[model samples]
Target: MSSYPPSVPPQSSAQQASQPTGLRQRLADLRGPAVPPRPLDARALAALAANPGCGRRALLDGAGVDKTVLAEALGSPAPFGQSQFAIVRGNSFEAKVKSDGGAELLRLVHAHLDPGGEAPGPDARVPDLSAAGPEGRAARTALALREATAAGAWTLLDHPMLALEVAGTPAYLEPDAVVVHPDGRWTVVEIKSFPMIDGAADAAKVGAAARQAAVYVLALERTAGKLPGARAGHTVLLVCPKDFSNLPTASPVDVRRERAVTRRQLERLTRVEELAAALPAGLGFGPERTAEERAAAVAAVEAAYAPECLAACELAFHCREKARAADEVTALGRSVRGELGALTTVEGALAAAAGPGAAEDPTAAALYRAALLRAEALEPVG
Candidate 1:
């Protein structure tokens, strides 16, 4: 999707004037007066959906605070980044796939997504989406989408920007490419460097890609909703390398399930204004703030920590440390946490299992039985 230096849609003067100054100032204060807010991408949004209960993450993201930097300040820097070599390879492959005025890309789209429809010809449109800023580019992309839908032609939007409101803030997203079919259907095209061997790729990678693409589809739907007779397709084109070669191959991945799940999770998020309003006064996440201050600020808000947060959240390491210190059972894993009903802490679960109450509580009885079995298995096996 879109790279850093986030391209949020600019609010009209009247719209800006109408906003409550108190909430906006609070968010700005949390982000720091001088620091710019990092723009949220599809990947970040998907991660947010994966762990929707983390109010800490929700507020940080909504305010556009740079979590990578914030994580570093907390001494638990996020362990994710692309290597320079991988970056070069991805860029090269993407350029090759979109070459020849995206002729190959369009051909693949037609063959895979709409084979029964008319094939894309040389006359297919690749409209100019260039504009002065992110807001302009987003508006221009929307206009192009509308025109393409009205004209009923095959079109390709390269790196077009889109905006989705999350937690009362607009998050700008950019898909690798969005293909407009001849029948006015919009399909998101994701280009990745991973190899597809024997018509299959890594399942985990594909799942992650699907979740990210689902975000793009959701944003596309918002844009298409205002246009008559326009609809965003549920299936997306996942373009990747063929085996070890740079030759491009594509698969149609259905994202209806992911879309539904993400939509529900997004809806469940607590609004940013609400989260900010709940924070104590003078709580700032600016780089100049001391580590103790930052830690205290973060701890003031409750975080639902789980192992999955390691992959999806920047502050996961810090949260994990806090959870372990407090003996919170949620740090074990979501499944484990779910299975230990009413036992929020490890000590509490252990006490329940070893105490007289074990027989009265089903969960405690099960844990007690498991503990006995474990002790028996470890009994100095001769």
Candidate 2:
């Protein structure tokens, strides 16, 4: 999905100085004359960690280029669309969970994570996080958090805005909810519409929710770090519909591992400044630019294409086509790429396994043996 950067107030000098001179303008120029940097959500940002070597995703995302648009323009549109049923179901479930000043939400938090703790009273504060832009709302949320912590009350921040600096750009994030405990501890609440069948949810969905919540935990930790004695809980509340009904059941999902993975993945990202420096003299991805020009500009940067990228990245189709044309071994998978060593292409890998040097190379030797075993097995069947 394409989004323009929110109209945020001016940044402080410290924020400005975080970037080198001309970096922002250069990134803007790369995106095109009029395109706004597409705000990267936690989900998109987290996917980057999974594909660490994809320089194209990093640079395009850093520059805020709209990959959905870019992919369509390149004649390989991304097959991504949410069913209206899901959109409505998610919204309805979340609203039900947070209804009545988040009374139900507090109950679930108390029931799942802190069963021994006192339940929040009717007067539990649900902070109005409304503001002019993402930055303003994020600041407003931070202030509310501090006040709630100081007051030592149960506070629910509904849809709090957060900003995480990624690749020299601020990626704005909004979590489902952030709950402040009376004891100054904070918990992130992820409300999902997916039903927990027989008290068990889908593992993949749970994992995705955890990874997404990990990003919120990271953002919340930043806020907690500034306050004395205030700590963000490593365990997040994953609230889902129970047994296909609207009733919300909660589980305490430990996101410590996901958090560490995300943190490392984000850190491993190639800096936008370094990427911009490596670019050719003039390259632009503006909507007005010709399809060929835009494709060439995108091609100038390398992409680490994998089968999994098809699920997460808009440019997967285009990249997969390119990988196929080049016979890149990575198109099969990273595991295959690792086994091939210096043989980056399928033809090269086959050649290596058949060559005399196969005996000297461990990977080639293994492939050579595996090929023989497969051939023998198939011959008997024939």
Candidate 3:
């Protein structure tokens, strides 16, 4: 804040900047669907940066950007954009606990468990460090300095916010632990006192860490703007204790990974927009549709494919709900899809309805086929 981004000034420049270039780029994006994307926060940016492969899917989910639209944006080779996600599942939580904060003493535990949220130890051990306090300010500056020396990351002691806007917002990122891997690229590292669990970073509690790091990346990129010396990569450093009371240790995770994931997500979500665009006059995703219309849509998805739900997927709940509510067999998770009896796709229904002796099945498939046939037959021959 002291250097780059200038801290969104609580005063004058706010008017000149007109919503800070950083926020503008993030806020101005109007690509995908009828759905307005949620404003980009540090959380959203961090997510995209973390994903580089399949993590691209989360970008759409995290940003609330439609998936089909995102898929289109990505077009061919992945990672045009991205999102954040939890990488490991199996006991990463316990592993994190074992590796963080040595202060795992029961007293510390009781302090958290205790009705009154008081620190178990005297206040001296855990100081109230803030930029305003002499000790806090000194510690913060020192930590910032230490972070740069150790990481080889691009450190802006106090960068200025003069970069052009992307998506309309100024790119003012403040990087402390910008690790330029052997690849000679720039990575922004954040030192956190939190513990790491290979869990969803986008979840409410952990999302903040990623988001904060992302904002710094944005600010730094904006301020540094394509300098020949500028490194093209990005990341976040999450520092946590190996034991409850132990001093924290840090790990650098790629922000690019998250971004890659998010981009794919956006691409897929855009399909809803496509559907809306091609839909007949009044058709929509709204509940106003009659049961038949809803059933028809559901059947359409079910006919073509079944998707397997996975433990690592961020949208398990969403998939489950849609699968349950609409009988979208395709929405079922792959692991259990076969067991659950959902292997068929929408095409199967139509095929069955048009087969040599097509009247046996009375399901939605036959009805839909009949509707199409009736509509087509109704057209007078030219």
RMSD of each: 2.6, 3.2, 16.2
Task: Please list the C-alpha lDDT of all candidates, in the order they appear.
Answer: 0.86, 0.83, 0.37
What TM-score against the true fold does each predicted structure earn? 0.93, 0.92, 0.35
lDDT tens string, model 1, 111-150?
Answer: 9999999999998899999886666788899999999999
List, residue by residue over 1-382, the lDDT tens digit for candidate 2: 0111223332323333446669977876888756666767788887887787899999988777889999999999998866777787777788788899999999989888877776889999987889866767888999999999999998999888887887676777888888998889999998877789888899988988888889888888888999997999999998888996899998899999999999888888888888888889778778888999998998999889999899889999999999999999989998888867877889977876665565677777777887777777889553
Alpha carbon lDDT at 188, candidate 3: 51
Alpha-carbon deviation at 110 in model 1, angstroms: 0.8
Superpose all Cα atoms of candidate 2 onto the true structure and report the RMSD in Å to 1 decimal: 3.2
| Highest TM-score model number | 1
Query: For candidate 1, what is the TM-score?
Result: 0.93
Q: Which candidate is the best by lDDT?
A: 1
Candidate 3 local distance difference test against the native: 0.37
**TM-score computed on alpha carbons, candidate 2:** 0.92
Q: What stretches of model 2 exceed 4 Å from their correct place?
A: 1-21, 376-382
lDDT of 1 at 380: 100
**Candidate closer to the true structure by lDDT (higher is better), 2 or 3:** 2
